[model samples]
Target: MHTAPQKFSRALTALAALTLAAGSAHAAAPSYVGTWASDLAQCKVPQERPEAPLVLQEKRFDQYETHCTFSSAEGAGDEWKVKANCQVEGDAQAYDFTLTVSGDTLTLTDDAGSQDLLRCR
Candidate 1:
């Protein structure tokens, strides 16, 4: 007992809902979900000695060797933010960092400065 216009409207509404669900399902994974090595040159780290590589393992997202333990992480598109407790020198510090990734390159920004890293193969 539906008019042509009513049927069309219902179909349009169903299509819209399906589109929204598909969009959510297609959300991209966080780009920082892998191991990265400091690009000493781009990061401007002193050439005296190379910096230790960083590893962001799955699930827990614990960055090995960097002394960073992320408690919460959120990602939207290519951007990610994490709240972490990290050991700097010998002191434990709370750090929040924003990261952006493009291709094999990732840039991490924090209170100090931004550093560029390359994905580890």
Candidate 2:
């Protein structure tokens, strides 16, 4: 009960549907292009200086702009900014770091030095 013309038409229709679905799926994905900021306590610090919290803000991926406000428990605070490159690890959406990630820590480097940003969930 199947004709060659009908088979060809059905195949074309299926192909068209597949193409449309693929295009829509690609378009619906969110591009990581915004400024993300988090509280100072969210970032992990070195064990020697564990009493201080660091505020971190990242703007633009290509031009990694970070603002940090680190304050010691005793009411001392220091702020700094560093420009570098950044990228996301694997295909994760919530876990992005600067281009200087090493081992399990995300690193930020500039004319000053490098700092590691441990991922905190």
Candidate 3:
């Protein structure tokens, strides 16, 4: 009799754990839907006197929270573009950068081994 109750408790615990896992997956990644400007100090390379600011346009698609991506356009005389999936993990939001995130920043490494974004607005 007692064994039956123990099993029921275990089952309930498992169900709760699964639900929490799924919730985190949803929470970890969020839809990107705003215009973010660049923070100069967050960049891998500092901007020169004659350079324009970097701007990013984050858009969500199909109302799916996890299926959103961001397109970044930098103002460094030439047309530079970077793409990444955006998400919110715990208390921090990240752009993924196709690689890593440091603090409130995302690092984009190109084929040429260069970090694309320093800070996202």
Candidate 4:
């Protein structure tokens, strides 16, 4: 009832499925999704800090009293451009920020200026 060719094809299909599953199992989160701070000491501060740690999610970020929800983020592994509506000191504002990451350092650039941060462990 079973032909050699059919068995070979089935085996190949199973192998392909196994390979895909293995690859996906080892997939990692994007490099930009993490907590970053000015230094390790800053990581011990509150959830996020104005001049220290910055907590980032896929579509939002928080630093001290500043909370931002971004509409879109465009970029690759270690760099991204984000457009967000944020509340800073109780005032609403629109902001566009550029984030670049290298090793443990994260550099964020905005209308005001650029600041470098370290990844929190």
Candidate 5:
């Protein structure tokens, strides 16, 4: 019972809705999901070494002698704060840190200081 133009209009509306859904889904993903190192050259180091890239997943981050597991990341825009339970040098620790992303670099600021990491391509 639909006219040709009417059907086309419905299709366009559906397409726009679908496009918006896709964009929102992509936006919901955290931008900092990747393996990162202090520099690109550091990516070549073995995981056992201090110079190894840090591997960050949705719920965890791992480096040479440090690992942290957290429930979630919370923030808007380019910065997110994470409260993580961590293990450093075999000692359990709690850490509150902020992760900021700029292009292919991630800067993590903790109580110690800020460390800049380059995304491993």
Candidate 6:
């Protein structure tokens, strides 16, 4: 038969294990921390105009064809609000965009419209 003190010790040990497991399970992925490629089909783009792949770094976004360096990006719920300076076709412009991620898919919304992108492998 286990003594009262022995049972209490086992209970405390189990509680600690459960706490650690819960903490790890609730840990969330950082906002916009991966490479994503546009799903042209999902965006309903013309076959002739293929979208480029996008790679997001700590404070920069690179689309192979174009590059943008963000001044700030903050997470709000499932979305991130970003302010960036982008260079395209040799012209630099200030841009603001919203990014939302769900599962393996990410949606970027700007002045044009929303474009869905899949996480790159």
CA lDDT of every candidate: 0.71, 0.39, 0.42, 0.88, 0.89, 0.78
Query: Least accurate stretch of 10 residues (summed lDDT) in model 4?
Result: 44-53
What is candidate 1's TM-score against the reference? 0.57
Backbone clashes, candidate 3: 2
Provide the TM-score for each candidate, comma-separated: 0.57, 0.30, 0.29, 0.76, 0.73, 0.62
Q: Write the per-residue lDDT of candidate 4 for residues 1-121, one digit (tens) a residue.
A: 8899999999999999999999999877667778998779988888544565888888898888888998999998999999999999899999999999999899999888999988999
Residue range with the least summed lDDT across 10 consecutive positions in model 6 = 41-50
Extract clashing residue pairs from model 4: none
Error at 105, model 5, angstroms? 1.1
Native-structure RMSD, model 6: 6.5
**Model 5 clashing residue pairs (backbone):** none
Q: Residue by residue across 12-79, what tens digits does model 3's lDDT show?
A: 99999999999987753321222222455433332333233343333332121233355543322223
Residue-wise lDDT of candidate 1 within 17-78, one digit each (tens)? Answer: 99999999987657777767766343333223335466664323333234677787887667
Tens digits of per-residue lDDT for model 6 on 35-121? 787653433332234365677876888764567998998885568999999997668989999999898888999999998888766
Query: What tens digits encode model 2's per-residue C-alpha lDDT throughout 12-99?
Result: 9999999999998776311121222233453444323433333233333321222222221111112223333333222222322233
Give the range of the ten consecutive residues with the poorest summed lDDT in model 3: 28-37
Segments of candidate 2 deviating more than 4 angstroms: 1-98
Residue-wise lDDT of candidate 5 within 23-91, one digit each (tens)?
988765578888998878988888898778999887899999999998668986789999999999899
At residue 81, what lDDT does model 2 achieve? 33
Worst 10 residues of 5 by lDDT: 24-33
Clashing pairs in 6: none
TM-score winner between 3 and 6, please give it. 6
Return the top candidate by lDDT.
5
